[model samples]
Target: MSAAPPEEEEELALPRRPPPCHAVCSSRAFATLYSLVTYALVPAGVVALIEVRYAYLLLFVAQLLLAVGAVEWSWLAFRIRQRLLLAVSLHEDGPPQPQEPTEDAPDSSEHPPPPSSDVNQSEEQTEAAAARRAHALEDQPLRREDPRESYARLMAEAMRAKSFAIAPLADWLFCGQWYLAAFVLASLGAAASVALGYAVESSVFGSANPAAGWRMMVGASVEAAFVSIFCSSLAPSGADSVVLVVYQACVLVASMNAYLKLHVDVIASDSQVDPLFIILAGAIVIIVFRVVTSKVVMQSLLLVLCDVLGLVCIVSPLIAFADLIDQPMGHSFRNQFALFVLVVVATDVGDCLAKELQRHWPQVFQWCRHPLLKSEATTKDVEALAISLACGAIMIVVVRLGSGVSAFNAVEVIVLLCAMALGQWCRLWMAHVRQMAKVTTSAFYLSEGSRAGGVLDRMAVFLVAIIVYYPYIKQKYFSSS
Candidate 1:
């Protein structure tokens, strides 16, 4: 489904959250023949000789359709695996664990104990709802409903994602069929994405050189795979799951790139490989290990050495899109490579706390979240729990501003503010999951609205960052002749 404009997306009651900020032209996404109904076409008065597609456009369009199909096929394949595991799990472990909601349970929520007054109206309502849902859900156990019901519920909630469910590939991807063939199909889909990306940038866009094409291709492919893993659903699984996906894609790509760069240099003596590749690989590994390990992000040795590389993979696509409007956003893999190397690194990890070598930390590395969160915290005594996460988010923006002295982006600033506000709205969905506390059932609901918002937030920021404003590339490469 097409995404609505920003004004409509801001309204809470929209049917679907917006799509991800994938790095492709609007012509590729909308003006192509695959979606003929869009108003992007120029019509000649009935007796028209209009050039409908570019020479390679048809081929790209074909690949795009294939890409969509592959995505559904892959998701369905995993669903089969999930179904088997769920069935086996059910057989061996018996009915799913209950949330322990009973008539005797207190549906009414408790008073917020006085700890911090930063708790706002949003948190108050969210915690109250959490208590009520927890008690009420007890009446209807998860086992009573179908296990796959959660998956189906999410598919329905995400409007565009439903098309994949009904597609023929869904049935084919199910187990009890050619399991090996299904496996092969899964492998082929990933390969196709990487290959298509390389071909598009190198041949389709006609990059200045093959090296440039391959450079841009890495970020494009990683992002494509990343987006595919989550399916076309607006909702993402959770924070940890999301981080894992991004981390894996970035790590693997960065490693391959590091090797590739050195290999090219070895083959051509004059081909000077940037020393940054080595640093990029080192930094990404160390920082990923640090970020995923705990609640507080410990600054690794590599972060100091190669902080910009961590953001490069994700931001490459963002800046490339931004380069469309502003010239020389970076050196052309359509002009993102130079700035792709540039860093707007934020000091969100709080360096003052880091110098002490603080080993004791949290289970998750969030820039914004209170110190305490537990079972009782979801319902009662949330006064302390109601930390103004927005305040914490704002603190990070301040850090980012201080970090990026030049090239302030109004769009990014707006997105950062909107994200904190959006988090408050997501509290209801989050509270429900917290209340349920069923490991099996929580998977379905944890990603509810929060996941969609995360996806949309990233897309909006990522897309605007790229499609509108280009990162300032250093003058040496793109000096006006």
Candidate 2:
């Protein structure tokens, strides 16, 4: 039988395009619903706090819901934006080029060679080849699953492959990206806030034990300096140099302030140890260790240390609070120590989980190639929900058990957790914004080099410095004569 004419063959070769209307509508509807839910969280949280007697519990629930909504919305938005881009490309470029035939398809060599003939005959052979290419391309199945759905399926598979404990650590360590930086800032901020709060309270009450507040302030300032230095080292040309200088100044001023306020007879006394000296020694050890070990080994060691410290902190607080174990440390000391340990543990775990997710993302994407059912949820979603619920439960228990404890102390712990949560969300949201801008080519979105955004980035470091040293400022200048 004679092959069809070139025009008819070419027309037949093109794959049927799905109606854009249905996909666009569905995407927009989901985006709108997710956005509404995300926005509603703030009001819901506020209302929960105002109306509910146990507002913290309700607020926690609201935050958890908000987090889930944010993730879903982000994934959906990314997919929708991608689809739109594809549509635009198709419109501008005409039909997509035909794909090459698979190995399973009939070999071109199997057919008898066409005879060298007139130009018309050559054109007819070319049309036949194009028709076969189009048919092969059309035979390939289109992806129907949403990106979010795929992510969930992958997470579920990962969970099944690895135990809960190990999988989370790997996921966080690999997938976390910019989240680690945010967590560090948040933990530092929370710790600073707590220290500042205590100092303010001490000043107000005219307490003799100002040493605790002074020590906390000094430690926080030193930590700020270290962080600044670390950041400056990473991005030498970036704005971190200015931050490093500012933090160094803070450290110097804070140290001098601590010395002036806390008098000691050094000449008559025996050799005394300084906390700053201890901190420096530890820093030196860490630096040396990192230099000696491979990056992976160093990270593994750090993770292990954090896990050990976290477990110790979790148990220590319970033991001290219950009077099951005797700690020479004061009640305030124990409480603050527990708070610091908890913050460290939370941030470390988060960082590890993020890293692990990133590491295994290729496998996740591969696994997600298959279509997912609407009713299915990802392991990450379930795990996140579980964590939120567990945290809420623990907080409730703490609140109940510590009914006799001072309200100020309880509030301090709550504030610390809230700060960490806020910082995490802020980082995630910023990442989402950047990703959206990248995908959509939206000029309205902030660029990396935008001056306003840079200033805001620097502001985080600046705020930490100010908060850390505020206690010292109050003690030195704002004190009653």
Candidate 3:
């Protein structure tokens, strides 16, 4: 066989170097550095929150940005690794060989065997020959399916299974099996945050309504649900689950000490039964029902009902305990509650809209075939930015006009907008890293197993623990009589 032309060989040559960003980001050193920076910011943020009480809302917003950014970054990393592995595999395997022509092909060049002796044979001999041929065919090995074809088929099936439309609450409830643990952790984290907030308010102002604690706990659960839904939308496959769960668990543990300090009295002096015990029992029953029931619809319905009840719990106390906080700067519980609900709904709607646009907008644009908008990446970027801006505007309006909350003013809106921008920038940086890693010369290099990222992650947990215990330490031996 003749060798391929030089031009063909050149065209087939792999690039000697990958994109710089990908090379850097994919390195173990870079991963460690990034982890260090992110984890360090947690303590710094906590310190800022302690020093500037009024910035609590801003801190909360920043925390959300950090969390979303981390999960997104982790997901991007997973994608980059998968792509790199696939590329390497394909490069090593090279192009596939053409298969031999099958009997069914009309254009097959091979001719059938002549039937001279078979025609002269008797009926019994012909029948024996046919059985022998059938046996031979059955003994032959089956041809393997082409890997590329199988991959394409799977991709098609996955795309078809994906619904660009936002799932109904019932559907969302039962969708991802891995999400259950994430949701539980997020809910616990939110509850702990509320507990900490109650502790701070009680310590500073001298008293707090127990009812407020209950309301805050429920509100936190709703917040968790909103966050979980948002993260799920971003990464449908299971990449972000680990980051989400770890971060939320850290938050939960960090607030534990403070939570213990301003804790709601679970025991009722008038009754032998503890309300806490009853609540725990009820929770266990719900979980058991969810696990034991074979009916998916029933399970989903039960979960949805639980979420609704949590929301109601948050809102019910607003009207009755709105005046519980007498601080001039303190937000109206009613307004904050309303804003939380608005955020949840707005994010859900926005995610659905984004998903639909992502799935269909390309087809719309392709049909038009505008030269300026030919790049799919550009179109996606524009769509994402537009959605983000629209969501931000809606949030600003909600904050500006919503009644009951005095704390979220124009300044808070501006802060939130800035935070959103920062989060987007972080995402862009992560994307750049991923792209660089994908095209780097070091693509073939294996990364050394480093415990740095893990260590940093544990550090975050430790920091939260200290925060939770700080209040306890102060109360235990340092109390002034």
Task: Single out the weakest 10-residue window by summed lDDT for candidate 1.
Answer: 340-349
> Candidate 3 on 1-481: residue-level lDDT in tens?
2344333355357243221133556676776565555445544454344334432233233335434543443333443444444445556786445344233322223333335777654566557656655655454334554657645433323222132112233255656433454455446655676666567564533344466444544454346445744444334233234334334333322222123233444323353333234334444544454445425554344343432232222211221111112122323223432343343234323433654767766464355346766586756655554565477569657666654345665544554444444433433443355454342211222232322222212222222322332233234323531
Models sorted by lDDT, best on top: 3, 2, 1
**Best candidate (score: lDDT):** 3
CA lDDT, candidate 1, residue 263: 27
Please, what's the RMSD in Å of model 1?
25.2
Quote the lDDT for 251 in model 3.
Answer: 37
lDDT of 2 at 329: 20
Evaluated at residue 406, the lDDT of candidate 1 is 43
2 or 3, which is superior by lDDT? Answer: 3
* Cα lDDT of model 2 by residue, 122-178, tens digit: 777777877876776565433344545444333323222111111232246646332
TM-score of 1: 0.26
**Model 1 agreement with the true structure over 1-481: per-residue lDDT tens digits:** 2344333245335454222322222224432442232112211110021122111112122222223332322332233333444445456777544233234444344544434665565577767767766656553443333435544443333322222221234345644232343344445556777776666554443333346436544544544454434333222222222332343344334333333333222123355333345335545654665466535322233222222332343333422322222222221322122121121111111221221222235322333434564553343222211333333344545645655644435554454434333333333433343233221121221223321122121122223333223333223224541
Which window of 10 residues has the lowest lDDT sum in candidate 3?
317-326
Ordered by TM-score, highest first, the candidates read 3, 1, 2
Model 3 clash count equals 8
Candidate 2 TM-score over all chains jointly: 0.26
Which residue runs does candidate 2 get wrong by more than 4 Å? Answer: 1-233, 236-243, 251-333, 347-389, 392-417, 433-481
- What lDDT does each candidate get? 0.34, 0.36, 0.40
